[model samples]
Target: MTKIPTALLLTCDAQLVEIDLPFGHDCASSAERRAVLRAALRCDRFDVVALTRQWDMWIDDEGLYNHPVNPAATALAQRFGFTHQPYHGPVLLTGGPDAQGNTLPLLRHQVIGLFLTLQDL
Candidate 1:
């Protein structure tokens, strides 16, 4: 006889079904992945995704960074438009993509990390 592993599945009627998947004989993954699941994000007044990892801050579609860990990213930020704090502080909220095709940044961060991607940086 083949023994199949089953889980205490929660049904729509709020009942637990102690059996294999209702639709599948065996549908399970050997590897496990972790994720930070939250009911909602702590957004500011503008509803932009706030940088709740720390103090009052927010990130944006623009590649600008107040303090970047990657040297190349830092250089790129400066090239794009990055000035010292107090000099270039947060705009609270900005209207993106002006006539010059430049995105308005969400100013609020101390140290930031950059990721290598295929999309427009």
Candidate 2:
């Protein structure tokens, strides 16, 4: 059996929820993927948000790093005309892109690893 990565957990509208996904015999449809992204993003407030793996305070200290906004994030931003900004600092949450075009939940260590990879200098 193939071990699928865990789904990303998101707090939407104050509701902590996981992306709607199928398991075993079922696969998550594109509609489900859209719904998950729609709910996860806040266009009004987060039209353009920044993310980071680390902070150097001074720009010269280290080169800037940022996450590449994927299609999912871009679509959401476009729908609401929200700005899409990439960033690199510390991840307060645990998530990343999965094969299904949805964020997958990660452990603290996993998140740290991702951050390290993103901001590696």
RMSD of 1: 19.8
Candidate 2 per-residue lDDT, tens place, 72-114, comes to 3233224334455322221123344445534344445654553
Model 2 earns a TM-score of 0.26
Pairs clashing in candidate 1?
none
TM-score of each: 0.18, 0.26
Model 1 residue 66 distance off true place after TM-score fit, in angstroms: 14
The lDDT values for all models are 0.24, 0.32
**Residue 59 local lDDT, model 1:** 27
lDDT value, candidate 1, whole model:
0.24
Q: For candidate 1, write residues 21-116 as lDDT tens digits.
A: 122123222111000001011112211222222211222223133312333322323444453321111212122333453323322221122112
- Listed per model in order, the count of residue pairs whose N, CA or C atoms clash below 3 Å is 0, 8
